[model samples]
Target: MEWIFILFLLYTLIPVWRQQRIHIARYKTIRKLESNRGSRVITLIHRQESLSFLGIPFRSFINIEDSEQILRAIRLTPDNMPIDLILHTPGGLVLASEQIAVALQKHPAKVTVFVPHYAMSGGTMICLAADEIILDENAVLGPVDPQLGRFPAASILEVIKIKELEHISDDTLIMADIARKAIQQVKTFIKQLLLPKMDEQRAEQLSEILADGRWTHDYPITGEWLKEFGLSVRFGLPKEVYLLMELYPQSPSRRPTVQYIPIPYRVENNDK
Candidate 1:
């Protein structure tokens, strides 16, 4: 009887020990995040590891909260000086992504996006809103089609079921229909925010392409794409990004590096 009791206690204690370990790990991560929140510019990099769901690891998805935290960091910056946003995400929540993009646009400082690896989906959207985008030769950008949440997907599935019951459905069912509508919604939101700074037609076209493009993965657009889009893209990283601490009397974040290749566009006569 004592052996049975001991075994049960051991089983209970094992789970408790795991939980405590997880808590400690999470605490450390939060502390690390807090420690790096005061830089003049913030880099939103891609997830090297998979994201967590209910404490279980899965493929890393964009955490809007993380992006918001970065935005909050920018807000906390003293005097709102120009902020360079380094990006390397595979994209996540479209709405959350847009929120970051909007914040970057509304902030009273120039926002630059530096893509060293790749920016996709919502990541690309954030890049589009930037006053300038800096890309290395190996960097890539992707389309901005909004993905469906559980609620939306369930609703659509229900509609399909009802349609099938009513004998009014066709064999041409595709998510593109849903994607198209989502694209329109995102495009409208983006246009409302960006139209003042861009031409109506150009903005609309960009919105459409971003929301409905075939390049889902590994689509590295060239500088010519920006030129064709009529954006004011330029070359070279800012001087401040490369100067080292020895040469410049500033923190490492302010020091300039040749790693970033800036892309600024020239506005067209009609765009103006």
Candidate 2:
């Protein structure tokens, strides 16, 4: 009876233990790569929604939880050492993104942001603070236009302005004023994030382009477009980056069936 109880406990804990060991091994691999490159690395990757138990909605973005994680990683890095940031996100709360952007900008070391797939909305805002932005050949950054609930802030204001012009929805006029202010606040915040990389003139120009609702909220801005727009965006793929991405491959479906094959930690240590 005692042996049976021990076996059941081991069976229950082995998977969790193996999963944690794999994570540690991955972190070690990344650290080795960064050491070889003469830099420290931090990753801000959103977990795939497919990892959820069911088809229930899950968010993978820069949020309050990531604030402490990013700061902890930064603290672990030496003050004079350069930092490589791997950013893979769909974006999230504006204040959350701003906090990260400011931290990266204030770091005593050079910060480079690598976008493997895409960084949209508030994610794009964070990249603006990077000294250098590297994107995979097919990666993209999207408009930084703020959203009011499910609608774009600028879009909300436009609707109100149109209503006023057509002399309708007098009761909703106050909402329009709030929307306009919200849009302006977002543009201002983005501009401040870009100030370290570009002058006020260029910052305002780029901020307006990203926040003016000229393009759809999710419109992809390719590396070429970003370079042409005056950003120092380079297009290239780092081998270590590809290796890291392979470790946590994106799920192809919302409900993915996953199997964990347990291996000795020594056998699983080869990340190259």
Q: Which candidate is the best by lDDT?
A: 2
Q: Number of the top candidate by TM-score? A: 2
Evaluated at residue 134, the lDDT of candidate 2 is 94
lDDT of 2 by residue, 176-207 (tens): 67778877888898888787667899888988
lDDT of 1 by residue, 1-272 (tens): 99999987886677557656645654454344335533356656544321222233334556778677977976786555666776667788876887888877777767777766578877877877787788765566776655575333324444565665446444324653574577678778767655766799888877666555445434666655866787655555433323211121111233675555556678778754
| lDDT (CA) per prediction | 0.62, 0.81
How far does residue 2 in candidate 2 sit from its true spot (Å)?
11
The 10-residue segment of model 2 with minimum total lDDT is 49-58
Q: List the residue pairs that clash in candidate 2.
A: none
Q: Against the hidden true structure, what lDDT does model 2 obtain?
A: 0.81
**TM-score (C-alpha, index-matched) for candidate 1:** 0.59
